[model samples]
Each structure stands twice: as structure tokens, then as C-alpha cells.
Target: MIAYDLMKRLKELGYIKEERDPYWWPKSGSFEVVVGAVLTQNTKWENVEKALENLKNELGSIEPQKIVEMDQKRLAALIKPAGFYNTKAFRIQKLVHNMLDEYGSFEAFQKRPSRSWLLAQKGIGFETADSILNYACYKDFLVVDAYTARILNFLGYELQTYQEIQEFLSDSILENLDRIYELYGQEMPLSQIYARFHGKIVEFCKEHCKGRDQAEKIKELLV
Candidate 1:
């Protein structure tokens, strides 16, 4: 099945029903997404949520400047539930410091983000950078992860690289923009499409990509 077909199926299955908080990711354009993107690496979202709650309770908000000003040890302690606390804390602080130095604030960075600049950060890779771009900055960049690779492999695609998988899914949706508009009953922006599409993929895989019948179940549902 193609990416748009999967998107349609997921939508029918009741995913991405609205643009709001309490979804797979935080609300769009929140710095929490940037922090969650980094903390979510090699960890589950539940742990990330716990860590985020700790930060919120301690700092009142997940501000970049507050994070940069806080001691690394304290930061690590608050985010310990997310795993790799010390390392993630260092990476987060460095990223926030650089963001403030370059863009002055998260609002400024949101106004004008640089993918290349994000890639230059200590721990930000393609997936993480794209997560921030798509979810946090509301850019028309699709974020793919291990779930995407697994789902595509089950669907009989030979895409072996991140760029290939991303391009395939993105081009599929772009090619069917008119159909997508028809499906949604309005002209949705490319960034919103990318966000919901990625969210659907992640949520679908989490629900069905488990147990010994994982491949069979996914094929049965989507194919």
C-alpha cells in the first residue's frame, strides 16, 4: 500500500482527529516538543512524559533560557526518568544555549529555524531535527523513525535509508494533495499534512506492530 492509502486508513481508524495537546507529540510550536524530541531518543514517550512533568513542576515552564541557566546536575536529576539523563541534559543545554545565542529565544527560533543549524547541535540527528522542524516549528518536514522503517518493510518496500523512506511517504502525500483536501474537506497545509501523517504512522505501528503476528496484522489492516 502507498503512504496516502495508509493515511486514509489511519484517519478512518480515528487518528489525528484534531490539532491539540495530549497527542503523540505536544502541541505544535511548543519548545516542549524540542525538548521531548531530544529526550525521546532511545526511550519511550511515557518516560519522556514523566521527565517533562518533572521539569514543569520544578521550573514552572520548559523555557530554553531557564534550561540553559540551570545547573547540569539539577537538570539531569529532573530528567532522570527519561534515561541517559546526564547525556541528554548536556545535549539539551547545549542546544538551548546555541539556540538563544543564535536566535535569542524559542519564539525567535520558531519564527526562523535552520535545519542545518539544528543538525550541527551535539545530539540532534536527522530524525530528531525533523521532529523539531515538523512538530515544534510546524515545517513541512516529515519525521520518520524505526516504526516507519518496519511498517514500510512489512508493506514490501525496499527503502533502506531514511531519506528514501521519507521521500517516498512525502511524495505520496504531495502527489495526492487534491485527494487529501477532498478527504479532509479543506485545503490543509503541507506542514499539517506531514505532521498528521507521521503521527498516524507512529500511533498505528504502536498499536499493531507487536506480537508474533505483527506483520500479518499490519498487512491485514492496511493492505
Candidate 2:
């Protein structure tokens, strides 16, 4: 199999998510994905969950407007479990404040977040921006993270940039969807395919595929 074919190989190895979840992401299109996407940077998802629970309990619902109007110190306190809470709270505030001033609602913001809009914000990076675009708005941007880069390296391609890997994997996977359907016997929407592709890559790396020899474990399923 080619380096970018790892996602398809993973599915053949029984790694793709089978559930067509109603709430595909934790809280699809909700403020939670936005908050989690920001808080998750440099932190574990477990920590993000703890911080999210704190926010949910405090605000009764995760609303961008509520966050925009929140006191920075208090917001930081609620997200303290995620660590770097002070900075993260300010970052979320920056994003929410922008949403409020320009778009006026998450719905509006999600509808028209031009490619560089989120990236031009205070704290959004490539992965975080793509996370929000893909998970929050269900946009068709592919998410690439450390696990993706690491696994690809193990497959003998050492990419140096996030956009490079993201575009490469996305183009490769979408171009190979026919092969994927043939192998898995099902067709998935592009959003779900990208979402699950990222999810499965993270899961596979966390579960049985790790170390510098990550590719070795899945060699049998290679195309």
C-alpha cells in the first residue's frame, strides 16, 4: 500500500467506526466542539472533557455568547483542569468575541467561516481550525495531528508540514473511496469519511499501532 493509503488499510483491519451516530461528534455543531477544539491543544482529550464538564455545569449550556460575556478569570478557573487555562480562556474569548461582533451567532459563524477566518483569529492553528471546521461545522477539511504525522513517518514518508500531510491524505483517501467501498462494502459521506478517518487514525495509533514501527502491525492488511 502507498503511504497515504493507511486510512483504507485501517478500515480493512477493522478500525473504522461502525456507528452512524446521530451526534457524530461529542456535541456536533454545538459550542462544545469549539471549546474542546481550543482546549484540546497541548492537552489530552480527557483533560478537555473535564474542562467541558465544568463549563457545562457552570453555564447550563455551552453558548458562544455566554462565553463572550463571561469574566476572563472565572472562565479560566472553570477550564483550569485543562491546564494553561488562563491562556485558553482568553483564546476562547477571542474566538467568541469575534463570533459575536462579526457573525452574531454560532450558526452564522459556522455558515460562513472562510478558510482563513478562523486561522486569522487569536489562537486557532491548522489542526484546531480544521477540527472546528470539520467537527463543528461539518466542513470537508481533513484533520491532521501528531499521530497522523507519526504513523505516516512509519510508513516511510516523512512529511514536514501539516498542510502537506492533510492535503496529501485527503486527496489520497477521496481519490481511493471507490476502493474503500469495495473493501468495506459501504459508502460514507465525505464529512463522515474525513471525521472517521481522523478518528480511526487516532484510535489505531492509541490502541495497537504505536512506536516507530507502527506500520509493521498493519502490514498484513496493506494493499
TM-scores of the models, in the given order?
0.95, 0.89
Against the unseen true structure, what C-alpha lDDT does each candidate score?
A: 0.88, 0.80
lDDT of 2: 0.80
lDDT of 1 by residue, 1-223 (tens): 3877888888888876544553346756899999999999999988998999999999999889799999999999999999999999999999999999999989999988999999999989999999999888888899989999998888888898999999999999889998899888898779888887888887777777876657777888887
Which sections of candidate 1 miss by over 4 Å? 17-24
Of candidate 2, the 10-residue stretch with the lowest lDDT total is 16-25
**Candidate 2: tens digits of C-alpha lDDT, residues 50-151:** 999999899999988789889999999999999999999999999888877888888888888766988999978999998898888888988899988877
Name the lDDT value of residue 109 in candidate 2.
83
